[model samples]
Target: MSANPFSLQSLSRTEAAVDPAFVFDGTMVSRAEFSEKVERTAAWLAAQGIGKGDVVAVWLVNRIEWIALLFAAARIGAVVAAVNTRYRSAEVAHLLKLSGAKLMVVEAAFRAIDFAAILADIARSEVPALQKLAVVGADAVPAHWPSVRFDAFDKPYPPAPTTQEDVDLPVLLYTTSGTTKGPKLVAHSQRTLATHAASVAQALKLDPQRHFLLAMLPFCGTFGMTSLLGFIAAGATIHALDAFEAAPALKILSENRITHSFGSDEMFRRILSLTDAPRPFPHLEICGFAAFQPGWRELAAEAEARGMKLFGLYGSSEVQALFSIACPSDAFADRIEGGGWPMSPDAKVRVRDTETGQLVAAGVSGEIEISAPSRFLGYFNNPEATHEAITADGFFRTGDVGRLRGDNVFVYETRAGDAMRLGGFLVAPGEIEDELKACTGVADAQVVAVDLKGNARCVAFVIPASEPPQQDKLFARLRERLAGYKVPARIYVVDAFPVTDSANGVKIQRARLRTMAMERIAAE
Candidate 1:
């Protein structure tokens, strides 16, 4: 591989040279037009005095303009701090503050979200680092807010491509989904982003000639952003949606002959359940999904019975998404697993026993660790956390429990925190959750272990298919299928489970469920 591919400007230009770079917001953006936007956006960044090492905040949904900002920041050697559109005032404030973003470019209004009002909630002095506000989707800046329109109509590109030509300089920051201690900004340079994209394109076996991917995932997260980068790296065209909806998205996937795309299991289930369109989406060859919400049936098997091809995916903000993926040729049993062979040929995956603190052999469940090219430089401005995450031997402790197959691949299981000890046995909650799903009318199940009177016991939260199931019936079914220890101590019915969005996808907030489960048990 040539070092030429690692250049962000070169990659931008190469991708922009394609006939139609993107179909977004109901209009086709030509290659030349896309290139011009990159130049214009880069020029605007220069005019704003956003030079090397400065952070430019992006707070919008999936749009071509968002992609343009990414290229623009990379071109000017500035770092882009992406803010999730789903975030509210406090979350948004924290991200802007954590990244020390000097300029924030956000849409004035988006659907039901009053972005301007959210901005109003934070006083001018709230984020001291934010110097200027660049508003999109508005004709003029409001009186109270000192801001400029994100209009780069007649701006000129800088005389030179960059003041700093190093691709190793940080160019993007993805915020990690944190709990007790808030989110950490995960920084990645042009080299890592470019190399990882190229490696993923190869691993996915993408060809610009025929393969086209639907950009349904939100670009604020790693899963969405990495897929976008992979498409650009492969010189493939993308059809992007500003916002993802099931009906519209399904229509696009069916009509466009989409060959490769990535999303979550929830997204696919919704699309598949929308309408009986004679098994629609025939051309969808590679639909990589993260099992954010664990289900009873193997989604891949179910999807394959239809025309669509589905496979599991594994990645996080720290290592970046698509670090590993299930191959298209993998059997459904293997395809349903979260972990897969690394996209980078040089990437190393190993397991370390959490209790023994020693590397584990194949088929032994332990912490999944990786030494890969896709790994982030470190948690930005948080050296202590970064030090604790990566081992001295260079492997990143993924904080995920998994077992390596004898081959080069591995299988990701539940999170280390989510794994529970039930009746003196270390157990995966999914095991009990699956059995719970087998009960009559059980749509889904979330099992959590609650410490009850010094003994760890399993508690289940279930969403019904049409109506809540009989608690005694569900418990009886689990008792018949699983061992006495594996059965949930009690089962509770609910309309839906609670979930939170992260760098991965929409994940069920197990901690919240655990709290609810304990309360329910105590009240009984």
Candidate 2:
């Protein structure tokens, strides 16, 4: 096994060959077998005209095939563009066009959503670069298009030559949840990802003896993918689930004696809410979580009583997943503080004044800026956005407000813009606003995030063009156009919006609207 951690081949070689790498739906795959599958998949992709810099979009749920495709694409120097499985036709079309994907691997259907039908809605002209579509979990390809089954890649093909320099080039493209604007394509190189993975494994104390349970979180996002790769680098066994159902997840945790896992605060709450009786996991050791709310302290204490150490984690797609994590030796208060010390010694963290661009005193909240070796390269095909995000001195502005307590510990505040974290995903109110405004009888719409029992919920205020739009009809329209999570929970019809004077012009006061929403929800 090699010590060099620059490429996928080197990382896989570090793991024990006979160790179990993945256990998906009751089938365990050894590290050696996993490596061989990656090599064979890479060769098949290369035979299909995928080469260095080509984009291969993977649109599947948490499965062994999804993980194999990610590594296989990197092995052949092709970039893997992960498409969120919850995306509708409109969202899927935008990502396909933006990534310029040469090949797409998708599931036949998931949770009763017809993926083939959604793809059929997209015109060929919208994604001219997408040459082929491979359907997974299907007996045969549908007759609507020239598609093939995912298992058709059994024949061997010659592999492409890869170099260390090639490993430094972008090999993965992940979409941001889109806070202020539409989702941007974040590009990450193999070297950057591998370095971050090793750092995360060390911080989390993962090893060959650990068994990790992965559920709910999609591999398309940085959080899940980083954890997946980190566990793989540590030679740990991964137990995967198609979705996050409380009953099934609890059963997996207890039956498998899972040692580690990651999830949002809400996910843990739902699991705990499943029963009044204590669900014990004697082997459970550590669990990393983010987006912690006030109620999480009780849940953390309960999990601790059950022998599980739950800690806070903070990171983003632009920062290569986790730059900060709580150490096991830290105090219980510090562990729940949302952001901990930097995971890597080379990573630098600072809180700077939003207006002056100067470093602020410790304990003072400001924009969180970071300079790290494992940071993402830049946004794909969008140099202007990249330039705006990265500073002149190489620090990336995280768009998050936070403060350093002392030495290295940091506390997270809120987003600088009007973004909100809902169900463990960052979402931009603008996207939902656009959909609402397009509905019949809607003249204008403004969306804001309101705190409801420690959970961020979208509340939309709309001005009708004529008669007020039927709430049920409007919601149905939104359901068809956007993901279910993006739909607003409550809608309020307003005659006009409250505006505030700004330097540029009058702006809608989202903060005021948020207050109004809280009061309204309370009254209801």
Candidate 3:
């Protein structure tokens, strides 16, 4: 590969010309057929007036077409902004508007929410830059907007040619997990994505002989997106699922003879919980997951007993997905305990003192900062936020606390700020607190993450104005306002918050609140 590799057009052409590419649901799509699909999708996008440098928002679940549109956008110079399928009207509108998406490709509905209706409502003023809408699983376009059936855009047009210089241009914009605030768009180029994908594939020892099963994680997320691309780059067969269901996921893992897969500790626990009977996969070799806590360690042991090797991974959207991933040759303890080796030689990781900003000793834990070639360009349309994240000398502050050992392995400790990882997504307690404050009978709200059964669980403490808040009503409000993962597992109403006297001002002592939450849960 050169400094600027050939665009997806050339790569897909070469790969397809050599062998078949993807196997989804039970159907296998040959390389030649996949190339044709990409070309056809690119033609349709061009016909819709989407060309070089344009932004298209994709709101769909994991499927072959989602992957097709990703490469098709790369075939031209257009950028794809992935929207989380779990997002509601407000969340979807904010992403589309912030990314300045000119076109939106979405499904009619996933589960119960009518996405078509939501998109139609937001199209008027929330997302003014949006010009056209193409919907999948819909019979006809809705009235009162410029819309078209996703399949109707298939009128043939020639695939556009791309240059090496264009490969370095922005091609993908993914949203951060909103650890502190609302999600921010992180930009990446074809060069960065390709390099990162290849590095991950090499680290995971992926090959054409392996079959990958993707469940739980959505393609809109960095974790799933990079895994999909890395396996494709390795020419591996893919088995995709729109969502994670224990029985179906287990069936796929056993029936397909899946060799590799990725998921969260909770996801794996659920799959294992389905039955006490031994579920074995002789062909399954590698499994990648997050959160290497004690509970996760037991799960890893159980998985190993059944013939699959589980390893811990540490990364974020800012680092182009997996900055550090466990390799297959690593020891069982190291693979399960450490965050693995850095993906590239060009990537440097170091820890700094939180207050002094001085370099910490190699074995000392502190804030983890990284300088990598595969780092994202910056937060789109927000230079201030970008400057805040990336240091003056080009190092990106990961906001994660970890230590680098003597053997060059990184061990993750915890998040530096109020952010917590729940259900494999980095979430900010403030987001949940905001929703809680909006609830009736709530005067003030404070949220802290506490470890429950080895998974991060949000615990909300409320200060009521009138009377003690009802947990049922507050939970009902949260269900309507936020995603399911953001809903607090336990709620408590108190007269006042625990505070500490400080030189600056009185500050709420979250550590004490966390202790209170733990005691409450333990007592229950």
Candidate 4:
């Protein structure tokens, strides 16, 4: 981490021949073994007519193939368009065409997921730029999209290509979404990812020796992929999992003594409830939590009390994951709040008042902007959007609301759009949601603000816990626990919240909730 010894081109090459690099199920893959795969996969990409700057869409889970293909594509100076396996027909088709992918490598079959069948539904006319489609776990290939069954290695690893490698070469294209009609493809160069990986490893205190890491998250998202790269930069042994399941993840973490891992609060809470030991994760060093769901505070407190070091994290596809880590040498409460110091030493953060459009003073919340080494080059094929997102001074205007804590340290509050201006004062919906959740019979809650005839009003959507929560009791609790203005204008009980899947994880569609709230109010 002090000096990143591994880059995209030299990833598995620098390690000792017999050094353990990846472990899957009960098998271990040595650096030499993995390096051979990288070479073979590089040759495969070349054989498929993929060249420099071309895109190779990967529609697979977290496995050795996913990792190998990433380095392989980098070896050939091509970009890897990491596609989330959870994506369906339309999403898959959109991403494939959006990236204009030259080749797509996917798992033919994973669990009950029939990837080949899904791809069959997509017409070849949609992805005309695609030259090849390779699938693992099966031998047969579709007629419209031909393949040699990627894992067979029918052809030998051709001589290493004569292409060149540079730190600024585009090597990654991650699919991300905002309030746009379609998802944006985030572009990143070799230098940005390598540098961030090294910085994160150094900040998190990872070592190749004795630090066994788990690839629990999917490789399609920056959150999981960046963690994998951090493992590579640290040269630590990786336990690659195809997908995440609480029962299996617990077994792997406990049996392998995984030193570091990262995931959402809901994921960790499930693991916590299922484990019987007082010190469930005794050997865990630092488990980063995203605080993605309700009850995160309780989950964080319980995890720390069990001897596990759980720290908060903040990052996005544009910045790559682990952009800002709250793992400073501070108290647990402070450290577990996301947006501490930038992982990159050269990075700086500033806050700008939404209304004034000027930099804010210490402890005042505003839009958080960052200038960092790991900042993305731009959104792929979206020049207008890119120009709008980056400021003149080169800071990425992160649409996230946060505050500067006086010393280059910062505290990320919420997404600027999600931050509500209730009663003429800015407030975080999490406060209201948490209050509503603490009420009897409330399983989960989401808060949103809508403009009603000339006034902004806060409203809530709740997922009930078995029995629907009574609005009278919910209002009573909100009045007892929070300010009067912060109380939600109404609450609607439902079986589940609206969600959309991404590489990161399942995210509640807050925008959709706002629309629903507006309609509900209009009908009043």
Candidate 5:
């Protein structure tokens, strides 16, 4: 057995101990076979003189080759930069330059996008840092750059010994949502991410028998990579997807016998819609969700109706998987009403009064802070951001509002990031959305502050059920749950939110919806 303490290399090590003939993507890539492949890739990479601390950017989608590349990077102590496959030329170029990647692995054609053309454009640009580029699943190398096919590179190579620290910097950076700047790079060491995976795997009770169907992107983002690493660390199988679509996902779930899955609240909604037509994915035992907007019960009921239990998960890019609400017992409900139940092991979470910066009572609403070992190292190349996001005591300022319930559970209310003043009072969109979610016929709700006559007004967007949701009924419900001033001044009963594609099952991108709302209001 290898002496490595905490690298993804342990994936093969553990799998070898259990079932070596595990089915990974139809073919049975045994532990011995998988280890040999990883070694071959590592040896090929080492031949290129790519050693410790080198950055290798993977520009492909979810595939066996990608996993090979990732493990290879881990073995050689190279930082793996999982490039977002959705990026266009400009976005791709920016990440390549920012990550300072020395090698890139891509395919000839990905869906409709031409990787060769994009590389050609990038090579023409001023980014002279990139040295080698390999094309996977391609026959001929493009004239723009020297390349080898992914299969041709596969060779019989012996596995090399590596240390616990050898995998320390396997993952270099995370691609943010680009709300303020161009996707600020959130950096993490392998130890940090491995710690995160340990927590997540423990929470899910993942083992070799646990098969998870991944319904998100395959990038360096926390949501994506965490799913990959967490499953791998648990010696489990992960069914990958290029993207999430409801109908196809349902089909895959049923056919693959996928037991566990997760997505944003929007994703659950889409899965619910599929079951609404015909019962889809009856085999799914557990499903997790994060709400960009509140009102998960409808989707939960839909999943339950289809034989799947739904659980709420609260996490962020800074902290991979913070906490989860699996059971809606008194403790869970009370925690949700307050904010969220603390679900992390040894993760110090507290709600601090915004005014005093002092820890608040269990039920009091305050800024949520977390101190955990798995916390991200820092934002890449941005010390000011690192300082601003974390405190002197090492507690990461989550910018979320919540409270704790005793020592075990933590409850969250709203995000400190979205706090805006309205009529000389602080307004929280989550409060408004939660109230709207309680409204009859309102399947889901999301609220954002919009400037009206120089004063912020709550703009509530709702997704109604099959029946036409009565606007008057919803307004009355909000009146009961919220203050008159806090009630959304303007309500829009949208058939579906444009930002959050609930049809796909994930958090609704509020930034996209905010822009759409502004455009629609202007048109009116």
Candidate 6:
């Protein structure tokens, strides 16, 4: 295939040239109008002395203007460092300084949180690398800081389009994981990101007529960037939301006539549980889910009963979605027959053994690796990490366990790091923990497998809310949610799990509770 104009500039051009009157933010911003914002912002970016290859950190929630900054940075060829909107002073400061970002665009205040206060606490002066700061949603700019009035910034401009070399870097910066694990900087260039966009559009079957409202975070990670760009590529109308509250999201679906959306299984369950959720919008088409805990299919079925096509798409922070996607229309036999994805005729899938580093036979479980055009170049500034992730032959090691079938489809077994061998069958802890969360009194839970003299033992840790979570109750829940082998051999109840969030509400540490669980087990 030829190298198409797949960058933001080209995508903007397509949206404007084809669908000029498309509504964004309850008003139609003709393609020309949107492109003009891109230009004016690009020009302002140039004026701030931000040139190609520089980093422009964006710190804000999902909004039209937040997207404007992202496109603006792309147009100027600057890498957009998408900082989590929930980052507190220290976390925000660390990202801004670490990325060597010379400029930042943030919300002055939103909801009840004062972003200005958070910025002030971080102290820009402490980081000399930051030269300029722009705040939206505020009237009075700080004495020492520069601000971009959201309305004024949208004024039309006919600035010249940036050169090819100018819009090279697609995205940069680290994304915080579930636990306090150090953030890993994941980088992708224009080419890699565009490929991802193409994959999403193909998999979801999005088109110009389909409008999508995303409930996930608007950042550089797997959930936001890839999905948004895919919608843009499809020339689909993207309805923006500041955050995901089941009530408002359902209302948005009813009001905006949202046809498609994406979220975690937890979020989808909440939406399905909403008493006021619409029976089904005539325009509603698809609802893609990620990060399944367990009982996800039941929720998907509930959404399907309401006329939405629900699906489970697996992906990672390192490689934006589409590693594997389960279509809602697939029969139970199809799921058992190695699964399915919206694959082009040329796509390939393989399962390889972790121990021998060789391809595995059909129906045999092994590590799932990819040799796809859409995979990232590698992790940013960490060649060793990259080397471990990607193979000598160009395949990206997915770190996921799966098995191939005679039908050429791949069945995901579990995450390589999280799967345990129990009585000759592999047991995935996530599957168990997901089921445990469904218990009436259980607030949250986690499971880990310990190897003991050639045998595997499962340990489970649980969190109770207002009432004590009985082991028998938890066991019954597990029995209902999972197979016997996948159940934990033992269970431990805890007062609370360890978690840390940025001021903006980004989950920084997920595995901290696991460590705490291990410590408690040792003491016992």
Query: How does candidate 6 score on lDDT?
Result: 0.64
* lDDT per model vs. reference: 0.82, 0.77, 0.75, 0.81, 0.66, 0.64
Give per-residue CA lDDT, model 6, range 254-284, as digits (tens): 7776777777666776766775445756687
For model 1, residues 1-524, the per-residue Cα lDDT tens digits are 12355756565545333557788855888767887888888888888888888999999888888888888888878899989888888888888888999988888887898887777778666688888888887764452346888887454645424454678888899988766767899989888888898898888877777888899988988989999988888788888878778887887887886798788888888888886876687788888888877762466667878877777778988888988888777788787778888899989999888877888889878889999888888988889989999999888999888889866699888898998867766578888887777778888889999898888888888888877688788877887898898877778888878887654357888999999998888898
For each of the candidates, the C-alpha root-mean-square deviation to the true structure, in angstroms, is: 2.5, 11.2, 11.0, 2.7, 4.2, 4.5
Give the per-residue lDDT digits (tens) of candidate 3, residues 1-524.
22345354433422422244666666777776776787788778887889888999999887777878888888778999998877777778889889999998988777886876776566467777988888887854563457787772345666555433477787889887543357899998887788777776666666576556444467888888877777776777677777666787788876876777777776777777776656566777767787422245667888787666787777788886667877677788778764678877678888877767898887776788888867888888899999999988899999887778755568776667656666766564656876887778887788888999988889999988686578899999999888887899998988888875321123567788899999999999
TM-score of every candidate relative to the true structure: 0.93, 0.78, 0.77, 0.93, 0.83, 0.82
lDDT of 1: 0.82
Instruction: Please give the lDDT score at residue 304 for candidate 1.
Output: 79
Candidate 3 whole-model C-alpha lDDT, 0 to 1: 0.75
Evaluate model 5: give its lDDT. Answer: 0.66
Residue range with the least summed lDDT across 10 consecutive positions in model 4: 1-10
Better of 2 and 4 by TM-score: 4
Clashes of each: 0, 0, 0, 0, 14, 11
In model 4, the clashing pairs are none
Residue 268 error, candidate 2, Å: 1.2
Model 2: per-residue lDDT, tens digit, 447-502?
Answer: 88887777777989999988779999999998899877788889999998887431
